[model samples]
Target: MRGPRRLRLPRTRAGWRRLTQAVAAGCVLALLPPTWLYVTTGGRAGTVAGAPRTDVAVVFGAGLWDGEPSPYLAHRLDAAAALYRAGRIEVVLVTGDNSREDYDEPDAMRTYLVRHGVPDARIVSDYAGFDTWDSCVRAKEVFGVDRAVLISQGFHIRRAVALCRAAGVASYGVGVADRHDVTWYYGAVRELFAAGKAALDVTFEPDPRFLGPKEPGVRRALADAGRRPAAPLPRDAGR
Candidate 1:
């Protein structure tokens, strides 16, 4: 290796010191917005410590690969299913991204719920709920959802509730307890940015991709036999 290669690198102690400073700075930067929002909102910006319950438990998608639900996604659904069994919520709305040609998150969520003993009829899938705001908006316009319990980790539900308030939804959140050893460092960093973006989603009514073309609100079931022309029942029974 020649004669120490002309000593181009920093001394070992100095290099370690610089690396430590960089990591510290990065963590501080990541914590700012959630911290700020909490301070600014009078400490209401993080997860609700013991959130009041609600009607619908909306299960937001965490991730998927090749048509299978990730463990994080499964956690959200498990919480929702528990809520339903405990009578804390009436329905579960599985919202997720389905942008790719072969992936479908909502159905994956649905299958999970059904296999776990949640009745098929109690679950609803929103094919276009690609994000939190979209799910809340579609809840009102498409599914007639006036109240709900947003499901996610403790750090995420705060911004979610704030978004719900902006959309005129009466909502609370159910925080899924996570194992401490699970590695979430990157997601923790990303969530600080997500919080700020959520603050925007609160005030901004950005158009959803499936809004104009998709059917949102419930279609009445057969119109109680022969009332509206769009009703699909036989034409002669009670009329």
Candidate 2:
């Protein structure tokens, strides 16, 4: 038998140029979603002091450390707590992954918030927030949150706001510092793909991982937080 035929490759200069152009075009297309998310939500995320008061402050989970919240997570909780104390948000919904018994993110988040002076009655724990999309979907479907203040790091808040809004919770965001460390940089890099995924999620509108009958969590939490008025915030609130 003849030796395996040499695989024919694009040998011409024009063919190589076309291949390069195609790759460049693909990269540009991939970047569109991240660009769109940043532009659309840039104005909506800011410091906690600038965030508008909403019906609930949805604190998305960062990682945990030794059965406690990591510093990044603690920062998010701090912002939510400040929002609570300022009377800007009526309730705090701690949403995180709790798939494993030993690594319970939501429970750890709730413990941190409670220890920081947030009343347990005003804290609603969402144990199924496996991802940003899951948290956004469950917040709307299970928790009955129509509007919310999202809390996360600066690099992530725009995507959070976009995903939550697409999930039908009219939402703003409070972005904490990015920390400028290895973890923060890794998260920022990951957000490029995450933003693209979010765009597709918004387009397809997939159901959440878990959906149950609407619980009274949102209403009860708000009532327990003293039924803070949902008045319109100043235009500069989202500065």
Best by TM-score: 2
The residue ranges of model 1 lying beyond 4 angstroms of the native Cα positions read 1-32, 36-53, 181-183, 213-239
lDDT of each: 0.66, 0.86
The worst-scoring run of ten residues by lDDT in candidate 2 lies at: 230-239
Task: Give TM per candidate.
Answer: 0.70, 0.90
RMSD of 1: 10.4
* Cand. 1 TM to true fold: 0.70
lDDT (tens digit, per residue) of candidate 1 on 1-239: 45665655556998978988999999897676687555433322223334334446678888885678887788778877777676555567788877877888988999999998787776778888888888778777777765566788765666666666566566566667676544456666677889777767665778667764445323321122122222111111110
lDDT, model 1, position 83: 70
- Local error of candidate 2 at residue 196 (angstroms): 1.5
